[model samples]
Target: MSAPRNTAGHALVHGWKWLDGFASFFGAVVGGFYKIPGTRPIKTLLHGTWPLGHPLHPMITDLTIGGYTATVAVDVLYLITREPGVGHAADVLIVASFLTSLLSIVSGLTDWNSTYSEERRTGMLHGLLMVVASLGFIASIWLRVAGAEQRDLAIAVGIVAWLVLIVSSYFGGEMVFGYGTEVNRQAWATPPTKWERLDLSESSLDDRKPVVVKAKSGYPVFVVKLDGTVYAMGNTCTHAGGPLNEGKWVGGDRCEIECPWHASRFCVKDAKVHGGPATFSEVRFEVRAAEGRIEVRAR
Candidate 1:
């Protein structure tokens, strides 16, 4: 809930620091759940790291939010017109929204598991609000399903749920625009346009051992030799800017490296993400050896 450094210009956000303690504990639980054997595959899909190359939570959240919004509109119309058709439409929309909410929760948790500190706290708060709102919506649905007598009560409950959803959505936006959660760490990285020489010699690099070198553009590059060929990529992991050099090599035939922080994996050859929690590829640098020294350029 507290930091050693000064926290200014975040007055409203700082007030929510009390939630950080809970976030740390729950975040550890989420991290442990994913670390369990046979769960990584599910985690990968939830993160949308493979096919989408972006976080999936944001992709599906709109469906749930939109559905609920439409349901609220129909509910208001039912209140004014008392039309049976409008009421039926509202019922259908609430059901669809409830289902999609489950999806958004799963994907959001998958991404939140990789967050830390203030981002984790904000995400936890956001998730809590969403869950509460979803439960309220579920109750509203149950009331509507009970009988026609409870229709007005259902509409009231649904409207309250929508308001909670709106507040929760604000926290979700803060996690992105404010904290950059699940955002591509290397998005702004500019690879070296020309060859850049490193201070170390080729012989100095131990086979299969990763090293960090700065490109002409001052961006760090991760360099490693495998099977007598030197490969280079952005040293900053696309997941959360974890130092790739600090991470260990993983995967036998895949030429993958695991991020030290969140365990996200990336292919060394193409810099493509090979695991969850990291949806963007690292910036690959073309590498070569000349006069026993290593050189790299943007691919």
Candidate 2:
């Protein structure tokens, strides 16, 4: 079902689409939205280089959520035992959570600047909530350091902040599972296991030109012929499902297909990433020509 057009957050996200303009303006003035930095290494690192195939922001979020939740656990323990040491431990956790939240906030903003359309608007609200949560934690720290009389109130606010953080996290998940921001495009995809016949005549394919044809399993398969040899891989780009068949050959040697959408380059020979914004490799396939037809299957 389509999302509610006039819901509570409608104005905040898409009030006649005017909010998009303001958001675009804000992002451009602050951090050059939609213009991913040309520095490949830096963009790769910030975008999705660490944690093997995952983005760094998600890795850092574990600490942010864990540290904040730890403080709540300590707070409850203090309330139950009336132990001063437990309160002290809660203070430490709060401070740590605040620090890690800074990193999470920064990484999130970096990702946010790269996001577009409604997802970008949703991310803005997510980041704002995180900032509010951070402020609450900082305030809790100040109050705890001030005196014992403020400890109870500080814990109260800290718990409230933790709650807000949870809500913000829900939005984050929505962005990924719902809008597919920074998510692997082929995570649920399954290539055909058995050999599948290509619909086109082998002679129809031109050398070095990629063609997108449906495999037996029906998922799009990218087929390319080079040097009298045919190659096949998943038609969907691993980065964002951009049509690889529509992409142009890159690397000046025709070894890669540069995605037209995000410019994520994949090696035509192996489907491995030859560039940034796509950490995962595309699914490779084996192909053979028989008589007048081309056949392919998952590798």
Best by lDDT: 1
- The C-alpha stretches of model 2 lying farther than 4 A from their native spots are 1-22, 29-38, 49-51, 79-82, 146-149, 201-207, 251-254, 274-276
In order of listing, the candidates' clash counts read 0, 0
Query: What lDDT does candidate 1 reach at residue 96?
Result: 95
Write down the worst ten-residue block by lDDT for model 2.
1-10
On residues 1-299, what C-alpha lDDT tens digit does candidate 1 reach at each position? 11213333144555687888777777777778977899988888899996888889998999999999999999999999999999999999999999998989989988887776666777788988898899999999999999999999999999999999999998888787777778788889887868888776899877789899876678898999888888999999888789988887788784899999888898898888989788888888888888999988877
Compared with the true structure, model 2 gives a TM-score of 0.81
Q: Give the range of the ten consecutive residues with the poorest summed lDDT in model 1.
A: 1-10
C-alpha lDDT score of every prediction, in listed order:
0.85, 0.77
Best by TM-score: 1
Query: Which pairs clash inside model 2?
Result: none
For every model shown, what is its TM-score relative to the native structure?
Answer: 0.92, 0.81
| Deviation (Å) of 243 in candidate 1 | 0.1
